[model samples]
Target: MGKKFLKSDEEVVDPKATLEVSCKPKCVRQLKEYQACTKRIEGDESGHKHCTGQYFDYWHCIDKCTEVQMQSAACSIHCICGFSFALYSLYCMFLLIWSMERSDEEVVDPKATMEVYCKPKCVRQLKDYQACTRRIEGDESGSKHCTGQYFDYWQCIDKCVAPKLFEKLK
Candidate 1:
């Protein structure tokens, strides 16, 4: 059987940049619904009781939009670049492993390696940030409760994690 390639009906925006500006029709409809829900929530003082379900639906619509965008981007990259990027990534991974093995003569403590990579507090904060992202992956509307936590996490990574990790590399 012959392999099917690009969808003949799909509009190509930029073959080089792989960006699709127009979303699918269903996504457009869902976006309209989400916007209407938002407007209603904003206008009504007691809208929270009635709008929670709509908010979840809106969140799901946005999530689907993101999924479609990512899928299209991946398809564009694969179609344009083929296997070159994949091969390069594999080559880099090989070099990293080879270099690590070459330094095996020196006794390296795993704990020390981790400490050099990031401070203990930074590591905890990073984990918390990751967990928060995962927790809100399905219900991103809940992220408001985590805004301060996210800020702290990024601050730790910027001020403590990056410096330690870069210094260790040097």
Candidate 2:
């Protein structure tokens, strides 16, 4: 009369497997933008070659969107517990200061700058540098190796971009 236990090898199917998962429109849009940027980076062999600034811009966009999604999820939980207003106020203040700081520094569009200033010969080296950084970025080895990777990536970018800029300027 005891209930029979399924064997460990037996597959247990979820009843909700047919249900559709929906994301907020903003979240969907952000996901699309991130995907598009990733595709562009992957596709444009020459255009993004010497453009570390563009790479940084894309990375920042994805990071900001991810943060927004995380904050929105946290806000919902906080709202249920009556702390959402305080969190929202702090978030808004942080955004304002961040926006001001971002505006203080003029961001040069790297693609345009490279088109104007960099030589074609540097493209191969730039591509290699970008590939190196991309690999390091995906490394799961925590902060132990990240500091060295960061240094190497920046050094590679500098070597690839700086000389071309100086040579073109002169």
Candidate 3:
């Protein structure tokens, strides 16, 4: 391989995107219907001609094929991972409560509860970050950035969350 200095900046492609492109061939019929609807309504000045039905039909077809593919694929590899994680966590919590794996004293979500405590302590840092954002709003030149301020705000939150986050996750 040739020496590539900017390899670290390479874009990450989601597996689900590839799956969707593969499933597109199965939905070509719906796709053509949508395309035909648009073509048939191309120059209608009366505004009566519309393709809402065909548009949704195509989307429905794509979603059905995507669902089938998702069932056969690893959910962790999907694009909607955050949503899946949230639902999974809620399910796990429900199961834990039913199985008596977690006691009443154990915090179900420590990071959220801790953030409430952490935020107030870091109000000054938060204000500094907010002020930096406001200052950057007027800078048309791309040289200005609020990265330091952004990091400062997040660093405060992370510090406050760190002490109890691992303990709660356990």
Model 1 lDDT tens row, 1-170: 46656798987656323322332343455457667757744534432213454557545544545454555445555545546678755655555455445422333434335545555667777677778756754552442334556678657655655555566673
Local accuracy of candidate 3 as per-residue lDDT tens digits, 128-170: 9889867865554546666688678879999989978887665
- lDDT, candidates in the order shown: 0.52, 0.49, 0.67
Q: TM-score of the candidate numbered 1?
A: 0.27
Each candidate structure's TM-score, on Cα atoms with residue i matched to residue i, is 0.27, 0.24, 0.38
Q: Show model 1 residue runs off by greater than 4 Å.
A: 1-21, 35-43, 46-50, 82-170
Ranked candidates (TM-score, high to low):
3, 1, 2
Top-TM-score structure, candidate number: 3
Query: How many clashes show up in model 2?
Result: 0
Comparing 2 with 3 on lDDT, the higher-scoring candidate is 3
Ranking by lDDT: 3, 1, 2
Residue pairs in clash, model 3: none
lDDT measured at residue 161 in model 2 versus the true structure, 0 to 100: 73
What number of backbone clashes does candidate 3 have, counting pairs of residues 3 or more apart or in separate chains?
A: 0
State the local distance difference test value for candidate 2: 0.49
Cα misplacement distance, residue 164 of candidate 3 (Å): 56
